[model samples]
Target chain A: MSDRIRIVVLLFPAMLIIVVLFFGGLVVGLMRSFNYMPVIGLTEPNLQAYWSVFTDQEFFLSFLLTFHIAFTSTVISSVLAIGAALLLRRRFVGRALVNFLFQLNLTVPHLVGAIGILYLFSQSGSFARLAAEWGMIAGPADFPELIFDPYAIGIIIQYVWKEIPFIGLIVLANMQSIGEDYESVARSLGATRWQAFRYVLLPLLLPGVLSASVMVFAFTFGAYEIPALLGANFPAALPVLAYRKYTDVDLAARPEAMAMAIVIALLSAVMIVIYLRYSRRRIRD
Target chain B: MTHVSIQSLTKTYPGSSEPSLDNLSLEIASGELAALLGPSGCGKTTTMKMIAGLLEPTSGDVTFDGRSVLRDKPEHRGVVMVFQNYLLFPYMSVAENVGFGLKMRKVNKVEIDNRVNDMLALVKLPGLGKRKPSELSGGQQQRVALARALIVQPKVLLLDEPLSNLDAHLRFEMRDLIRSLQQEMGITTLFVTHDQEEAVVLADKVALILDGRMKQYDSPDVFYKRPVDKATARFFGGQNFLNGNATNGQFKTSFGVLDLPIDCRRGTGTLTFRPENICVTGKTTETNTINAQLVEKIYLGTQTRLKLAVGTEFIHAVVNPAEVENLEQGQRVNIAIPPESLWVLTS
Candidate 1:
């Protein structure tokens, strides 16, 4: 009994955080989403907010936009990550510096990464000035609009830039542990370099690549800050739309905002379930 | 004619001054299965890797059929190595593993399948081709690796301790299997082993290497009967050594003097012989006889190992069990070291 008491006491802080910030907040959000705001005299339990959000063409477009942004960024990041990991697996001069450059952004907040993307790709950013100096364009106005565009190109660049090294680290670790013996054996047996890589290293590297890709996809699917900062005003990402509606001045708009937040949470939950299933198929001995 | 010539081969790993293989040179004849015998850290595997192009040498060239292959890519170099661990691709089925090289060569699917089946049958794993490498037994996995390498018809086949992982019965079985397979295929093979018996029995010629240098290269009979040096003599089971001074044809030792049957320089030398070669008898009258007191006798059916004490030296002799059956422990016996049986090792 005392041992159980000790464990419970040790876990009390973490459990309190989970209950108050996670589940307790989730319950409040759910109640508000169902039109149960007693303070505003709307106490009847109903699914009107869900129906409104589902029928709203803007909401539907934002949801699709969110999916498109996450999916595109994830696919691009996975390809770049696999290529970088394969290249870095070999010993080369300045590899340490390259690895350090990748890790430098890893721990920085996503907001910071989004700001970096905006600075590099904004109309009046350094790239435009350099292009102007080179006489490639007339002025900063002639620079292409990459950030805050309807295509969400800036949001994608931010997410992909941050996630590539994250996924590459996981894959490089797996490939290094697998060693180069199998490739050497293949070469000894008259396999050309590309043939050896395709028939041997690719099969061995697939499981690691796929598992890391799942993590990358799940993370980008629910990411809020980068999309909120870089996405356009109209077809905002799901998280950005929910956050914008939550901060609106109208008191009655909170319920719809709660509904969108609930939808985002549910979609993230589904992604986590799928990710767990894929993770269980991890490489076996 | 030499099929594989490793001329002045040396490999010094980066940041190391001492070479792993120091200017080593050896020639392997066409269709000859040669065993590269050495103790651990003797650069046998290094030499083999240099030939396979898996590892580049610091200085030297390896040629197949008088053509230099040092600059060739490993895929172009028609050399294959069956590594120590039998590295069968874990994700591939046995048949797929065997067919990989053929697939790389752009062989037709039908031809690849046919050759894979035939190769599986050749390695005695015919019907088990669909099983993954992890599912096969150690011996079966080894065969799969062998078949995978052999299906490509490499110009030089390198076998690196292929039977080391097997149990005793399987070791002997695979030993015979490998020998017969090599003979049937007529592949010029380089077999690396630390096992002296495996080196002697498995190869048409044995090259005994020590400290990354070749000590002796000769037939197995020469290795056993007339080893070139002390290392080869000891490695090839030279159990008895009588250090003495040689004057003319006679070697004078503390125990007794024995006549050297072969021509020897009149100086200090060592007489080397196997225990079984020295005959222990009750009567002795002539050359190469040692009169010693029988100290101990171990009766191992068909042969009795006798530990004889002469003056201050002990000589081990293996005689017929029947001859030593009735001998007492302190009986005087004469051990005849026949001149032909003794190898006068000068160094």
Candidate 2:
């Protein structure tokens, strides 16, 4: 056989799984999103599901809430991650233990983390009792509402907590690969320590930081479990709301739910494209 | 121009018993280019960092023209260093990289642009300012680094093996460029290098370092002709060492008695001479000539290396190929060593 054909044959197994499973599901979802599900006797494809989704006031609210969660969580976590990486890159006592503990949660499932946040941060949870005993609050019921609050503070906290180390690990590796030479050069060129980091090291680290952050943004944008577990009932996170529609007794809501899912995927895809373009320009420059 | 002085600089890294840089001292005259010449791990880089104020010395001071700079930070010390890899900021343009120091000093935009262009012209990299550092070749990037450091008009310029990352051809070109620029600008430069030839060719004075200590600091010719010890002489390519005891002006070795210079130290010592100083076919001198059988002949392109035996000890000499063309391995030849070429090392 030719080399090209042999390589394709070898890659066929992995290609089969991705093309059949991932793109296949995406095509099916796109089909239903246009109201073309033949199982429901709707052979005609149209934009009615999208029209209904865009017409709903609650859809826009859920979108803003989801955007807020993703953007705020990503920004906060990215800043904290950069800070942590800078500190961790230096040599110190107990650094190995600290780095190990910082990355330990990456193995834990997101659902488990949401549950932990719920157990600790809910109004009647352990923190509430502790606060009541300490006279910070009169009773458990008087504790501030974090979970199931209108602002989705609990959800944002969970994401920021989990994603800090996720992005921190990437930024740390990037910092190490960039090394201290550039900063040393900057210092010798009459730059103060802060200026060295700000001008030279920060610009060098931006491409890696942006790529890692885009991944976090996309994951948090489309994820459902964390929002569903600790979200308000009135205007839920977009994914949670879409899932609710997917499981509703009304069969017509299924197409709108698929439309929302496709919308979420499109937004995340847009972010990834921006990231790729930026990194490409960086490499070329 | 600034007179650079390093007084008893020492550094012992944490958890290490041996000092990385021992009590080292140097006095570089204003506008002089001095090289810290040593093998790798010989504390050359350590001493460079101490002078640049990038490293904290365990106990000592670095001064510029009689002012101690030990309390100053690296930026405040008015010293800049060009590193081995020419670490140009990848995100910046050539002009920006060169003007970075002026920008840090808050120089105005128009002035920075003018000076950046002038510096670029000085480095022979004019009109390449719009390009990024990554787009330039290795030699060009190195020129950009030199321009960047020189644009700051630093008191002392420290180069830590600056040409080490380049190819052989580029290394030679950069060596010429560095020497010309140092002479042109009259900057007090302390260059660190492991190559003896490079140190000799570029430095006004070369300081030979060995095992974390300064062995000898003198002019380039002195390092080759009058090294302080066996190691320094060996480092400078001295191949013939005769162990003997010198009393008054006469040296007694296993081979025979030879005349020593007037300043030769008395008692037990080793006498060293360069290989090229041994004349294979020449008029015999009365006291320093020896008759030995040629044991081996290795044909080098420009010179032939002949191993000779005087008694049980072997001596290697490099002579013109034409002089040794008729000589055979077992044939005996009389070789003369100039008395002035011999340097006695007491330690």
Candidate 3:
């Protein structure tokens, strides 16, 4: 009993910070989302903000755009990360150096990566100048519009570049711990190289890959800065749209902004719950 | 069944000066079980991997049924190896792991299930098809690995110290199971072990390796009777050695002159007699008898180990405790050796 009390005592400080700052903010925001802020003379709780959010067509478009960004980034990053881990697991000349370079960008902040992508892939960026100098394009306007475009290409490129190493590092460690023995045994049992990788290695690696991709998906779904910096002005990502409403001059827009934030958080939570269910089922299988 | 032959196989790993396996050559007849016995790092596993086509030989050829299999990949070689740790797929159940090879070959589901069930029965793991590999005990996991390999019906089976991870009683059980299974299936099998006793008990023919070199390749009985050299004799538990000069079937040592075995080489060498072969009696025999005083007596449960000394030379002898019930330290005793029991090791 004392040991349990000691553990709880030791955890109290950090847990106090998380509970007060995170759940405290969530509870306050949830109350305001129901339009029950007494300071603004709205003492009666109401669902008007959620009703307006659901009735708006732009909110639906923004949700689809956010979903597109998160899904595209996750799928592309997962495939590229698996490919990188496979190659990195093999021995080669200067393998340690290659592995170091592969994971070097993980320490970089996502905002910094987003800015780097904008500088490289924007209409007036270095690539446009290069194409102009090479006579491939007449001017900066002739370069393809990849930044602040309808497809959200620049934001996705930034996310994939930043998230690959994050997912790949986890998968590489899992592969190294598993070692070559399982594959060797598979080969000895008359499995071809591709068959061994597909049947034996891929299934073993799926749980790690799934967990990492879920985290990336949730982060991309609710992130604001990358989309705010490099998204279409009309159909902005959900978080950017919510921040826009929160900063509106009209005070009634605050409740709607809180409702949008709650919806985004709930969607991400639902995805996490689904991922947990899937991984648990895989383990049981 | 296929005859397996490893012809002059040699392997030098990268960045290593010495070869792990030095020009090793052996041939196993079809449906025979051969053992590669040696101490750790003596190239026993290296030789097994070379034969299994898991490691490429520097300059050699491996043949199966009189055809070269050096160019064949490990998957195409039809030689399955059971690892020491029994690397069953952790995510797979027993039935899936056993039927993995056949699944790769695209065998029908019905036949794969039938064969997997039969293989499980043969390994005495019936009705364990639903359990995961992690859910089973160590011995059961080992049987699943065996069943997995045997379900493929490969041309040869390679066991790389498969029972080294088991407990003593489990090792005995697995040894008997492996022997009966190998004989019943009549598969050409090669076993690698660092244990001399395991090699003797499980192999039809034993190949002794020492320091990346072949020491002897013969039946188990010959190892005790005619070891190639002093190291071979010592490895096989030859405890008593007398440095002597042999001339015309007679060996003269510091203790006394003794008749050597008929086929012993005539030279300045050492003669070895197993401690169990050195008889202790109350009276002298016809020949090869020496008087010694018991220096120490160790009371083991089954037998009493006696340390006897003639002048300054000491030797150990093991006798039944009942026979030496009255023997004590500092007592004089008669030690005798028969001529046939003495073998000379000229090294």
Write candidate 2's Cα lDDT for B1-347 as tens digits.
99998999899997799998889999999999999999999898878777777878999989898999988988998899998888899878999999999998989999999999999999999999999998999999999999999999998999989888889999889899998999889899999999999899889999998999999999999987889888898899998888999887888899898888887778998988889988885456555899999999999989999999999888989999999999999999999887788878874
Q: Taking candidate 3, what TM-score does its chain B reach relative to the real chain B?
A: 0.96
DockQ, structure candidate 3: 0.77
Instruction: Indicate the docking level reached by candidate 3.
Output: medium
Model 1: clashing residue pairs? Answer: none
What overall lDDT, based on C-alpha atoms, would model 1 receive against the true structure?
Answer: 0.85
Worst 10 residues of 2 chain B by lDDT: B278-287
lDDT of 1 at A140: 82
Residue pairs with colliding backbones in model 2 are: none
lDDT of 3 by residue, B200-301 (tens): 999989999999989899989888887878899889888777888999889988978998878888888888887777788778855788899999999999
Q: State the lDDT at A177 in candidate 2.
A: 99
Question: lDDT of each model, Cα atoms only?
Answer: 0.85, 0.90, 0.90
Q: TM-score winner among the candidates? A: 2
* Model 2 lDDT per residue over A48-149, tens place: 999999999998999899988888898899899999999999889999999999999999999999999998999879999999999999998898899999
Name the weakest run of 10 consecutive residues (lDDT summed) in model 1 chain A.
Answer: A276-285
In the order shown, the candidates' DockQ scores are: 0.77, 0.80, 0.77
Q: In candidate 2 chain A, what residue range of length 10 has the lowest lDDT sum?
A: A276-285
